[model samples]
Target: MTLIKKEGPSQMDVVTATASVSDQDSTKDVSPATKDSHTSPADPTEAGLRLYDHGGMVLVPTPTSDPKDPLNLAVWHKCMIIFLVGSYSAFSVLGTSGLSAVYPSLIQAYPNESPARISDLLTYPTLFMGIGNLFSMPLCVTVGRRPVFLFSLLMLIVTGFWCAFSDSLGSHVAGRSFFSMAAGQSEALAPYIVEEVHFLHERSTKLSWFIGVQTVGTAAMFVATTYIVPSMGIKWWYLIITFVNVALLLLSYLFVVETKYERVEATDGAIVHLNFAEADDSRDSESGAVRNGLRLRPDIHGPRTWQHDLRLFHFKPVWSETFTFYKDTFKSLAIPSILWLLLLNGAFLGIYVYQASTFAQVLMSPPYLFKFAYLGWVQLVQILDCVLLVPVLGYGTDLLAKVMCRWRKGVFQPEYRLISMSIPGIAAVIGCVIYGQAAAHPTQWSWMGVVAPYHLGYFAFLGANLVSITYAIDSFPRKAGPVLLVICAGRGFISFGLSYSTVPLISKTGYDGAMNIFAIISGVLAGIAVPMYFLGTRFRLWAMQRLWPKLNQ
Candidate 1:
């Protein structure tokens, strides 16, 4: 009667009724929830228990009777995890992108510093964030993800205060840098959280949705700060951020569960994953144990008490493993596919930041000299850009993956998701070209024409960014921790390089030449997608069989 049916195009986000999502969406007529489910003989590879629903949707990870297991947690509990993951990461985008909204006020407040010096408030923290990526994952893995997240929130709150009260530019830069270092944890840890809680079918939508939430939240902050700084002053604006961080910390404490669960591996030492597009017709049956999209767990363990969740000490606090992670981080970098995904993901991040750094500068000067406060309203473009992109990136990728797997006779590969990158990749190139031309000659184009396409360029980079990450996690589900840290650290470094080069490059080559050069770089990197589509699965399978154990060892 409602969208609560799990079989169709997976519901994008929560709408109250719990929805079931499958990588391979069922197209046949299936009985209703209360109807009895009929299943075929059990799989015998390991003396199989029933795993398929009546419509042949393979329950990811095969639902367990253990209530404490993450997969078996109440639907409401999983939803809470989803909300917290998106919310904390969304909050981090403010320190990075939203800071630019206050630049006009900052220049007036510190009349002694040049505009370029004021931009350091944005630049220095970016560099520190890359440095923070080096440690973000190891701490999550070695100490426990929950503790690391909690600690990062505390630091964000503390640093926000330091930034608000700072009397000198040097002190403010130091404060912002530390704040970004903490913010890096949220970004670096997000992928791991996505992999931990979601089923295979649900991953694409959940990941893209969270990324969208952050991007939209960032713009909303821009809109807020622009208006706030003019009326209350920049100092008061930061105080507002500090209060928000405190509230986020309180919410995180209530909801975020530690997501460091042990995953199962197959006989050849590969991770066991189910691809719904490959469903065997022989198993087109179901189990009565599954009802209303939940695995009916026995009451043997009793109801899970809050203590299993609220306890602070989940691990032994292994400080020594931090060194182990540091070593593995570099070792993981040598692997070819891992490296490609890392660079691909980082390049898009670099592109996004470059646009963020330049957009305010260009819009505030010359043919269109916009007032500082007015720039906040311009964020509507960014907000609209993300809103338009969420469905295309999230649902589009999931649907593409489902169809491609069916086309391949049910053999689903990670490369199937990369197809989502094609349109966005080209859009990025075009957007860069148009933006450079607009920036170089302001008289020819109106503000609407320039900013719309310029902000719209985000469509490509964000799509590419999410695709590269989703594919990597799919390829190496077990290596989610180490691999994510590598990508985050790489992007952090890449962002620093792009931010440092931007002003000098613009000065030497003119805005047109500087941005066109980025267009070329972006286009060239994008070319790799074709080969990745054709060759990615082979490399992933080989690594799973041959390379995975060696890197882990």
Candidate 2:
């Protein structure tokens, strides 16, 4: 009756193990239909009784040893890591955009703050957020994922509280910087989740969900900022969010059991005897010793005590190893798959973050004269982005897959993901134009027309991200995280650059000029999507064959 029952591999075609692995050893073809006639209900525990498809021994959960019992599916064990990471990411995004909606009030509260000074609140956090990834990624690689996640969540909570209560500019800047440190995880954790929880087939949808949820978070903050900041007061809004963030911190600590499983590179039968307790103690001891250069003795640490960390750094081939990592990193930069991802996702990111933070400020103030709470309401536009755009694009992707599969006599092609980009690409350009034109002559259009860019633009924005991210994952199945990291890093840089300069650009050139230029860029980029759609599949194949091999050698 439980959601995740301990079903035997025979009953449900599932496999469980102490170390849930997906290597060649576990890939044996032994479905239920092929079960041997001689085999009865032998003790599955009787030294590795071949359990259905899984060649390795089944590590059954507590309560029963029956191989066919419905009590052990690893998929059902974890409560959807997608939702967990996505929810926490939502908190960080809310923190980032929340201040944008209420900047006027902040300025009024502290009248001496200049435009340059005000800009730092937005710019510095984003700047640090990008740089923070450099540290976060390495830390996750070294210290372990759970600790970083917990530490980041705590940072958000504590700093959010400080930001809420702090009055002075110095405290606000410091708090925002602390919050930025956590906010950077939004980029790093995407791959972390994608790498751990989701399978290759399901990665795109999960990544979309991650991004879509974060978008919703920003939109929700926009809604709340408009409503909460004015009614509850700016300080109270921060306090409320502080509590919410703190709750997330607790949730992470309590429920978020470590998913940072160390990847084993050894072949089957390559025994890694880890004395985890001893490994912990040895790691503690070697932490200081590795500062100079010396491996922790196995005698002192024991088998479980052997760690891959400090040894990685101390290894004589460290430079070559580092070069190899960076070489792999930069090679992805030139990859067409990566470039395509950069183009579509990067464009949307640039526009959305830029418009949401800057233009929302413009629309809500005098002439429009919308109050702070109502200003936050601008985020409602993104609701249309999510509700309307995501489903349509998602369905288009599914339909295209069916069509492509049918064309190939039921053989599916990864190119199916590209079809969804069509509507979003055009819509993005049109939306940008509309927003620019509306801003140019605000009196000419209704609020709907003025806000049309955001609502309509988000359709393409969300769709593009969905398509591109999915496509990237499909192309490089194993290296999806690294590819996504570059995509996210590029997006962050583009968005931050645009956001910092948006006010100045709009001020000097006017909204019409600024948005018109962006619109033109969108149009050109949208046009590129066509050739990309046509040749993208072939390009992926070529990349895998000629391109990747040559580079690897």
User: Stretches of candidate 1 above 4 Å error?
Assistant: 1-55, 114-116, 263-303, 318-320, 550-553
lDDT of 1 by residue, 293-404 (tens): 4433446544445787776657787788788777666766766777887777677767677777787778888879988777788875676766766678888887787676
Candidate 2 Cα misplacement greater than 4 A, ranges: 1-80, 138-144, 165-167, 191-196, 231-235, 257-325, 365-367, 537-553
Q: Which numbered prediction scores highest in TM-score against the true structure?
A: 1
Root-mean-square deviation per candidate = 8.5, 12.7
- Candidate 1's C-alpha lDDT? 0.66
**What lDDT would each prediction earn against the true structure?**
0.66, 0.57
